[model samples]
Target chain A: MKVVEIRPPYLIFLGSESRATYAKTGAGLAQWRPELCSGQLRLAADTVDLGLPDLTLEQAAEAGVGSLVIGTAAVGGGIPEDWYPVLREALSRGIDVVAGAHKRLAEVPGLSESAAAGGAQLVDVRVPPAELPVGTGKKRRGKRLLMVGTDCAVGKKYSALCLERDMRAAGMKADFRASGQTGIMIAGCGIPMDAVVSDFLSGAAEILSPDNDDDHWDVIEGQGGLFHPGYSSVSTGLLIGSQPDAFVVCHEAGRERISGWDDFPLPSIEDVIARTVELGVLVNPAIHCVGVCVNTSSLAEDERKSYLAQLEKRLVLPCVDPLIDGAEAIVRGLR
Target chain B: MKVVEIRPPYLIFLGSESRATYAKTGAGLAQWRPELCSGQLRLAADTVDLGLPDLTLEQAAEAGVGSLVIGTAAVGGGIPEDWYPVLREALSRGIDVVAGAHKRLAEVPGLSESAAAGGAQLVDVRVPPAELPVGTGKKRRGKRLLMVGTDCAVGKKYSALCLERDMRAAGMKADFRASGQTGIMIAGCGIPMDAVVSDFLSGAAEILSPDNDDDHWDVIEGQGGLFHPGYSSVSTGLLIGSQPDAFVVCHEAGRERISGWDDFPLPSIEDVIARTVELGVLVNPAIHCVGVCVNTSSLAEDERKSYLAQLEKRLVLPCVDPLIDGAEAIVRGLR
Candidate 1:
């Protein structure tokens, strides 16, 4: 007779058979009504205990069990110390054990070898690798982009989103990318697609790369935050791949913290601009221009102009507001 | 006569030199001195009343005061509202007002235009900018580098230091191009260079990339908290400039709010790898391999190896311990 198995933690306790399994195995302990299992149970004569028989596994073993089916329920894909002895005994008796899901278990010590030794094979829960998408032969060209900030929560994404929007609006292809912390978590599988890739494939976006044949410009990938470790790694990877053409940065001091940021050596407008420009030179030799967007809530327009003049004097490129001027300054500076 | 300026919170009462001017020209008080400002007596040719000064320009013409300097002791750039009228009257006379470091008087509405119209120049305490050694043109190709973190404290600098050590150990030319946060802050002028950059420049350590010849790698850029918006922006900026060949991503658990992270859907290891890989792809098309460095306080070698293998298979990359396998796996995967 055929046997159907369910992993533990879903309905029954892990490491043991269900009360329904006891009756199906013909164990003389107690009989289960078909109604108990919604009539989905299959009565099998040769169900066997494959591990340390918890009370339920023991009853099934005593009832002359033959085969064991395993799914993700067993140890959440981790190895449990109690499952070994029963596995060994069952293999010795010529019973087959089938397992699926729980890829991590493939690395559990001696488990794969033991199963293989017993002539059993493990199956993965992922769509057979064949179902995954293949690579498109593409390369990123020279659409240099940069994301920067003065402090945390100071419109970094606003700048990036603006850049993406303005670039597309200006008829230049562009995409926003995530770096730092979000990159790390997402990199591991927190979402359907990593945030960086998501931006690239978004409806209104066009990736900033060489392969997509467009004229005025291709893609202008914008970054999310500053100095995030995960983003740093992801961005480094992108630079190695895409190689953008210009660097755009955002600086803000709407709060009193601007001057008080004296703890940082480059605390003033002059200092921040200088260092960012230098870094830009080191990374993208192709950086044609640099754009700085400043937050102006704390100061008046004249002061803002003065501050802009001061910063502009220091920066090799023009500095402007994204909300006010859009991509015009960036495009002009590059030109 | 030279006048000594004191900081804010001091009361001012008008004196005899201003009573006639106030009656004749309807001009308000002229000069202000802190109550205890007897120390400035020697510097003044005559004494004037200190109070809320009537600020008609004709009063100054009639009083023959020539020029008057109203001192508001605002410190730390905090400008109070009451000072604007006094500042405006003085500006109308083409008087030069020395604003306290804290008072952002220029930020007041109409004050910017007032200062310009009144020919009144606003001055604040300032020190001359310092000069530092710049990068040379003959250093190395692709030597100019920039490094960024995935998130704060995720070991961007530590990794850079290790990479520097390894490069030196292998006899490859390398230098710590930038000091990460310190460098960024210094360039921004948030702090004193004497305390930060000057010390480093004065030390025996070589600084590069001011000119063209110093091909150097920058170490670490970007910023943010543990999750959400860490280094995404800064990393993108760095990538736009430097385009490093590979990336090493360090990962940790997502925010605790994510339920069942250790299991399926929520915090599965697979999600992390996928997200990171997504960002890695944008950074460098050549980046197919992401070295997953699991952060555990301590684990036996066998356990570590087992975990690495599981993550690799799950994430589809060659995972390894930086302390053990070094960059070997990353290099091989990239190749």
Candidate 2:
């Protein structure tokens, strides 16, 4: 079952983030689910623009926005003090304030009281449900496709979202299963994998995507690289719990080292595919790689095509940039 | 650093447990650290005896017991309602009450008030420390050894404790680092691996056994088995965080299936050793297997020796029952 349920028709809040990279959450929501998002809220003049109409709390309320989502992440994933006033005002106006930040919105000094005063909910997507069962390792009755990565932030979420959209477009039954804060926000409901207690990591993953129809597909967003020294445990648990029948290897072009861990180089795509199969077999013996999703935004337009083509030839699998090329090729291979 | 600090001279509470196996926590403490234990307290007539003097609350108080440890585990690891009166009486007498049970001691009704009235601490070994850093995957100074297993409750903790004792006896600088509730209570301090948040599993493990002197050895007690379907994620995180220079494989003789997960067969010792080394090299490239530890309690005296001897020959490593053979053979191989 989904742990947190976030209301849509959101007003994206970009809290003084000048760089688009730092405002990924806001950008992602605006890009992927523009229909659910009503407008944007910026704290400063220099804040990154998500290309949506800017709206104040009064304007957002009048516009019938359901929730104000904090889209910008601070350096340490914390909620800034200046944003608290805006959040309090949003809650005081009877609009729920949703945050994927490290600090819980309900725990902020005056936010909960304001929310109570307006009869609005304070939703913290980062907080997991109180009760989570230990994973039984029993296979569920549905097809699953998990996005495995060679490094953190290598487009696992983007790949999973793209696959879900493309699969549905192709007349297939598919749902996007989010495992991180931003993905959970976009998906409207999901469990925060890393926030769960260690013993229940796999159990939480199992609950995230329960048994479904035989032909249905749950495109699970993966966390951390399997070869990642620090976060591999999270990845491993998600993999085993997901018990995916198929997986897509996600990687970023022009990246040679793991982000924030310079001492360790990123594992090869072949290594990730092999290791994922090795571990994934513990739960799903029929696990296999179906495609490769690479973020080729760093490469030139001409170079991107050739790069994917070469990779497809070498790996003997469909390769594409989920954002630029869409996951139609990958969806075609699922049949 | 250790998360919980339990005091010495413990009074073990067996709490209506008729089976010695269910009273493993009390039995472990009584067997491993008899010097620190004052006596055992049983609530029922047929409670399994640990051979220590049966002490009443009044007798334990007069005997100067530092803490009363609830040693027996109920069916679901929950504290039975019948245990409240005995726990309250112990706390009312100024004796600190320590428990490694799933339920927190302070949350029990009236227990905290009783502890406050008598100025006694209610220690819960299952709770992790508030602050823990994410694992950096940077190599730390000092040598380390970790005990891994093929399934849960297969003598990983016992083997680590045995190795620590034998290593010290052989004039080696060694410390036993606990990672579970029972191990934490036994060692007076440790991080409960399964209790930590999923994101910080490796981080908590990193803090549990920090850097020591160059010659010092941190013998860390392992958690779940690497091949365990439900628990392998915890094992993976701990393995990465511990980054053991040497490891010992733990298994139980006469058991061919995973406990509670009979559908899955127990992985062979060789499979465990190979997998441990494969994953362990991420943090420490020099990681290698030092020996094998088998729980041979179910085997006859003649069968036990032959079992270990054949294992030693096949695996080409020292094989012993930490309880029966004292782990001296494994300690010798460490050097």
Candidate 3:
């Protein structure tokens, strides 16, 4: 709801393609104008030559722009040649650049240079991964916290943040951690206690690589995929490194059991507890809880309650509204 | 946490595999320890051969015992044979048969026959699903409701129940409903509402099945699973259904993101609003609010609050404790 305005005196960066993103330039613009940005129109239309590094560099320097906003392009495979050096050179000059969503052009190796060169920065215009709890002496308190979703736009980060707030409100010491791919991005937030499935996802972990001597609690780590290779292995490794007193699992509720292929009616609570024990850890068993975040557009309260209650009774943990009490409950579980 | 003891004259009405269940006494005994049972002594230390029949006609004729309990080996699966004769006989003879967690099963195909034959009535030991709102013919005061989850047992039921209770307490006509598996298990909780994943898991209809058929006042449906195969199909279907008045998603909080090769961060609220409009639904672009539930074992209030605040700023959803204000917020959103 807060809007910040930028005028034409600064640099403007736009993306070349629109893949899996909002076409901000089209009709959706006026209707869905960014509420965060207000009082604009200083810079009308100034297109820098992304195809030419020298031209791009000259334009940036000539403009003496303190802030640069760039649009994103399609993300896949590799990055565009001109875009790479242009971005790299810009970063080296200590400029701030905000660009549109473009993966193929930015993420490719040797294409988008890692780190802002010359102190330049890039702000991904699209949504970014959430920050994690990264600070010193931050004790993790909770039996286990779980966020449920297999797809994007399922409200996972929202759920986690809400829980973090509630846990603190309830007077608990809790830190937000990641067990999946977001771990890499989350690290920017703080040093993660452990990454549950990072190894399986092929994510590059600079802080805690699973291969270099399994003791990796000194930094952040993440989970890979739902059923990725070595996911359980990495999870076990993280568990050992951080030795979390509690656990939180992210999940999607009311969805059918997975494919009926692997462990449908998955295991009883006892089974899961047993697995935890097998890993040389003993689950409090009764301390586990599930927070069910629902798509309000699609379900009823009663329906939501029934499914969660079944889990509560079966799992021997209290089922709660994740947005409301999930974080608090996780902290409590740690207690 | 609460345990009770019940003693019976111990007449056992058998279902289809009652005899087999009784014969495989060792397995049953192994599953439930003597210490956990109500009674001090085992009825038959050496496995009794009580010779039970399957599918008998003429209720009450088969039952000649008092304080009878129904026993079955396949507790959760296919209907057993001996149950019919026992139920019919029990009912005919005016004998009440006590069964554990079989009420839902009694409504199933084969089990219905067994109950008729043994004349045995169902006494459900399991907790019942919550009740639905009574039809008042008065238009609801708040927004139409929908509850969804990432997967099964992510606290959907508990959250729904809590919401229903809160809404009713706050003076709303909101009712709980079942759309997918819960519908078959519980009745009169609410009108059946199924979101995308529920329908996909059930394969009964598309995600937005109910809305496609009818567009009326506020409705709530429970969702299950997170991105299961059925979830995508059903969600797409439901999106094509009557566009949701407002979308609310329930998920687990305090856990890391579960990544996929294809999964990415949730779309920005602006993108979501655009999509909603494209689907012909009017919506407030900002996420109404988020309810975060957390475990409060050992977390500090400041820690929780800071994290929640950070999330609120990032997701643009005013976050609250689901247990406290989730239902109330939903009702307010309706306004």
Candidate 4:
């Protein structure tokens, strides 16, 4: 239900393949709030760039950039040490910096002093909650809706956010519970599910979903996929931990394989629905799928429309490109 | 494949729970290598104890106990501070101490000094491996076998160990991969999968399962159960990370419900087998259920045989009380 209205003078640092690799994080703000985009920043050696004029850290500070974004895919590595001087310099210059790395900026020694000295903020989107207690198998109240996906970067968060917006607009009680970095930025408060201890992964979900009335709905952003080799564990954890009463399967149009995994082919959408329902029931027998959220970003105008129509016919559930149509159908299904 | 032959005189500190709870840790050594059990130790508590004598830390050292066992289950808590003084005192007297608490003994502020001064060993079983990298989801070279269960303490580890022993005895390439504290102690090296970062849960399993020929079988110990709300995440992670070609369902015979969850009626054995296979194939299409390991310790002698017979008749796959039958039939199913 919460959303950050991204302001002007955005500084997009083109490090870690910002264009194609960290495309979502690098361009999410601009895409969500295009009117607020100042420009993009790139490394001097950048071959393929975002076409915005290259701006140095000092220049960005002088320009009074509201936030310097270091949105890149550093999935398995530590924070790139190269960005340290720039982050510290920005912090000293009264400009906030938002990073979506597995490493937390707050944990960097002396970074807090720089931020405090300049009265600027440091947002590490993937930072986990302070203390995630072990889960007790006690039954909870309220309906939890988790966005399950067929692959990583398949609009799981986007679909969940849309559902929340639509749900709230319809005068329903709904809150977006973020599980990853992008969702965290919009929600303002969320535990980066992938960063916490394994034992507390599902427990994190259990703790995040508040015990509210049956009318209340917590729309949780899911991560990974049961078919994703590198991240299926996380997906499974999210599936069981969130304890969803219903799920929306998110899939990108024409995704033949997982983003990085070539050895694995995508399972049929039918299989994904069946698999999620089975996985969900394993934890909560009453849980089932409500709808399908397809990303038509890769399809053409005619193709996108036809794909949605065909999907709706085949899925036998509400199917929509959540970004375009909102998750009204899913919310309707939930009700 | 490697088993620790515990030597006596054994000093089991009944600090956490001498009998009901932590008896497993205190007496596992004797049960695994009974020839080495000299006696047990206990606090001044006059209640039901592990039947070990009341031996002080000093007496334990004087008696030349090989390892002071502090095996007690402290779910959702830290190592009891009261045991610190005893542990330090024992270390100073040249006696190795084995602790299964989630909190590592070496991390204790001054315990390392006592250990160094006494030339004693400090072994913390639940320590996760340092520097577990992210998984690539590339095809691994070996055939891995995993033992999954319906609940925590349903004998996943015990079944895996049995399978490994039987497979190796039958002239197969087999090794047991530990995923929890007890399994880690038995294996000598493994990341405490539950204690690790959430993203690395599956990654830890990927790193542990070495690349070998398809003929080799990695019998990985699974933690938690999909139905056990507290630990399903760990189970999910183990299942996805291990990427087993085949799985064995581990169940405690004559159990009416989950170990701690009185509300949940036990799912039928058929459902468990079908569910595991379904879950397994979500990650690997060829994955299937090969067998079942029944923990018949709770049943009477005659009942154990009849229950296993009924299970075999109903399940069709190999069924066994691993401790008694040595998992020979389960291994045969895999072959």
> Residue B54 in candidate 4 has what lDDT?
64
Cα lDDT of model 3 by residue, A211-234, tens digit: 222221122222311221112222
- Give me the candidate number with maximum DockQ: 2
What is the iRMSD in Å for candidate 2? 0.7
lDDT scores in order: 0.37, 0.91, 0.36, 0.75
Candidate 4 TM-score, true structure as reference: 0.78
Please list all clashing residue pairs in model 4, or write none if there are none.
none
lDDT of 4 at B121: 80
Q: Please count the clashing residue pairs in each candidate, in the order shown.
A: 119, 0, 189, 0
lDDT of 2 by residue, B1-335 (tens): 54778888999999889998898889889988899999999888999999999999999999999999988888876888898999999999999999877778877999999999988999988889888888889888899999999999999998999999999999999999999989988888899999898889888888887888999999999999887778999999999999899999999999999899887889999999999998999889999999999999999999999999999889999999989888999898887
B95, model 1: CA deviation in Å?
86
Which has the greatest lDDT?
Answer: 2
Q: Report the CAPRI category for model 2.
A: medium
In candidate 2 the C-alpha lDDT for residue A320 amounts to 96
lDDT of 3: 0.36
- Comparing 1 and 3 on TM-score, the stronger one: 3
CA lDDT for candidate 2: 0.91
Q: Tens-digit lDDT track for model 4 on B1-335?
A: 11222334557666646346545655554455344444566555553365556677777677777777665666754677777887888888888777777677788867899999988888776666567776666568889998888777888888888888789999999888877777765554566788878777767877778688879999998887766666777777777777789988888877878777677667776776677766667556778888888889998898988888888897788888989888888777778
Reported per model, the fraction of native interface contacts reproduced equals: 0.02, 0.76, 0.00, 0.80
Candidate 3 lDDT by residue in tens digits, B1-335: 01111233234433323244443422232222222212111233343434332222232234333334444435463345545544544444545444444245456444445456545445433322222211111112234444444433344554555555566676665544444333212222222223111112222211212332132333445443223211222232223232334554554445332223122232333343343333212121222323423222233677666765775676565444455445565545444
